[model samples]
Target: MTLDPSVVTAFTPTGKLRASINLGNPVLAKRDPVSGEPCGVSVDLARAFAERLSVDLELVAFDTAGKSVEAVSDERADIGFFAVDPLRAQAISFTAPYVLIEGFYLVRDDSPITRNQDVDQPHNRVAVGKGSAYDLFLTREIKTAQIVRAPTSPAVVQTFIEQNLEVAAGVKQQLESDASRFSGLRLLDERFMVIQQAMGTPKSRGLAAATALQRFVEAMKTSGFVSAALERHGIAGASVAPAA
Candidate 1:
């Protein structure tokens, strides 16, 4: 796709496209075991978008989604991959989602909470990664449950254990991995939410730039690029979003 020069400039005012990548979300990105560099589905998309803009790609890496979102919101980075949330959309214009992932709740196997709706008891304290999609979503949706925040998503389970919280909320894949590392923990039979993961640029970038990004995302989804990336990266519990 040939974008207008203005649109390209909007995405790459620094001559290189800076894409904020969050390594905190294992399903989206992670440190390569051998090379110790960032690699995963988000990295692939960032590189591809930079190429579409015909600019050098500068990956600005963060260990948390909040930090990554802040980078793009502050215009420190030109673009980023993020979960579509109403709060984040205030400063970032997101495309239709390119991937869909589920949010789940985890608890000790002996715990009485066996269903997603059982988590909102007045006495149950839930652990969540501060400023994550889960945190933001649950903050609004969960009325009775108290939320305790961990420093980052990867630390949510540890925080839950350390604080003796009743529940840990996070990505299904992440919580499952934590369950394996520990004992006597199980996920609820159903997911609490479906996360729409999409590309975003600062709303300051203008409508034309946002439209270009939206088009890019839809094209990638329809072309099977997203599905291919998930398979290549061995990412389960996430799937390509339908074209918008």
Candidate 2:
């Protein structure tokens, strides 16, 4: 069967950021529980991208971020619309970040590991998604925590809620949300790895498309359009750092 046109554009109905956004995080994807339609910050941003492109908006949904990246790699989607890291950059070309985010550590609010440094102490069993940025950051930068890979944030929460683990790391936004679900848990100190949230295109796609998207995203940044989109979705604080 012919590839759906959305596949060619990385799930964007139009081949531009303004026309669409697709994501792997369903919590953020904002699905209509009844119609199962895609909705959320990612979808809204994609719509903004389409509007900037002067095209119609469309969003394709994926259940997980990893699968969203796979869609881009396999030409089924245009972008994953989430945090970008070095490994992902190697796998897919990315535009300059439109939002700056930080990774975080979460634990029971009453846990003794109150500071970021405490997590590094011996036998501190920290849970994190197997292939997630939290895993990468903790394994590489956070030398103190003994990592117990959980494969997904919810899974980590499951174990933590059962008192099976002490500390865990994940995206601050996701972790904070999970913390709300469990009364005992809360996000710890602001220890976070500053990351730029960017869009992706297949690596095989030449520099032209990637560069063009980057430039367009930058222009949107300067024009304050991106900020408007973020506020529209209640993500007011997600943006690039102001000039030094």
Candidate 3:
């Protein structure tokens, strides 16, 4: 796909396509165990987008979603992979999601939080990754429970365990992995929310560039690129989003 010159310029103002990668989201990105380089579905998408624009790819890596979103909003990076939230949309133009991931709640096996609804009690302190999708969502939806934030998404379970919090909130796959490492932890049977993971550019990039990105995401979803990347990276518990 040939992108317009203006669109290319918008995404490559620094002469390279800088993609803000959040290594905290294991499903979308992670450090290679051996190489320690960022690799996963989001990395593949960033590379493909850079190639489409015919620019060199520069990964601006961050350990948290908040930092990644900040990079794009501040124009330190041209694009980023992020969970779509209304608060984030104020500064970034997001495409329709390319992947859908479930947000689940975790608790000790002996904990009384048997259902998703049981999590909102006033006495329950829920641990979540600060500035993560779960954090953003729960900050609004959780009426009575108090939210305690960990440094990053991967730290939520640890924070919950350490602080004796009543619940932990995060990605289903991530929570499952964490549960396996510790004893007596279990996930609630039902998910609390579905996170829409999408690609975004700074709204300052203009309507044309934003529209081009939206089209690119739709094409990626329709052509099996997103699905293939998920499988190639051995990502489970997440699915390719339907075409927008």
Candidate 4:
């Protein structure tokens, strides 16, 4: 079967890459908001995988990271990039995390919420991508603040910039890229989750596929290919675990 040279996105701005890439406009394109390109660490990792796969990276952008999983589950792309969790494990397998991400509270940089406790104030609102690890984390941590669920990381950034919300929750890398746009927006250093970045395959084929995917990830980690890929993408601080 011929490989389909196509890309699909779940967000609006459509993340762009430098190489000969197939672009899929999704609802969530995390940007500098000022630079207007793919700015998150996730984008970097995804592009690196595309390069390694030797196929034109087909990014199926989603308004939120949660929606991106659908693309992988549907077989639209060979895999997807996201923070892995047990709930997602039931749907897809993940690669070893490349970066150590901690939970952060995003708010206007000038706001008094420079710390975690500040966000617990009544009437404080925080935004999160629906079904994202951050979203899952926030639902557990920030029960006091009203939660605004955005479709994509970019949209959540936009909402904060547009003054539609009070705070946001996500990884530091993503929040940092987005905060660069709204200088007024800043990330609170208090982190919550210990997430590892991994690729996912649909849980449909049962143990064989799951086993295969896990092995592929393990091989990538052990062979140092995964580290090389992360470095190529400008994502540092990731090391692969030995295959068990």
Candidate 4 regions with alpha-carbon error over 4 angstroms: 1-63, 75-78, 95-99, 236-244
Summarize candidate 2's per-residue lDDT along 1-244 as a digit string, tens digits. 1333333354344454322233334334556678878776566556655554455654656555565666676666665575676766777887777777676788876788887878888778888766665666667876665788775555667666665788877767767777777677778878567656677777776666566566656766787766766666666335653321
Cα miss at 177, model 4 (Å)? 2.3
* lDDT of the candidates, in the order given: 0.94, 0.64, 0.95, 0.58
Error of 3 at 176 (Å): 0.3
- lDDT (tens digit, per residue) of candidate 4 on 1-244: 1112232122111243212111221211244457666644446545754454344555455555566766666555556666677766766766565445566677775677777778876789887767777777667777678888776555677776566688887666667767786656666776756656565655553455445445555655676766665566555433444455
User: lDDT by residue for model 1 over 79-118, one digit each (tens)?
Assistant: 9999999999999999999999999999998999999889
Pick the winner on lDDT between candidates 1 and 4: 1
Pairwise lDDT winner, candidates 1 and 2: 1
Q: Sorted by TM-score, highest first, which candidate order results?
A: 3, 1, 2, 4
Q: For residues 141-195, write the lDDT of model 3, one tens digit per residue.
A: 9999899999999999999989989999999999999889999999999999999
Q: How many backbone clashes does candidate 2 have?
A: 12
- Per model, how many backbone clashes are there? 0, 12, 0, 24
Error of 3 at 116 (Å): 0.8
lDDT, candidate 3, equals: 0.95
Poorly placed runs, candidate 3 (over 4 Å): none
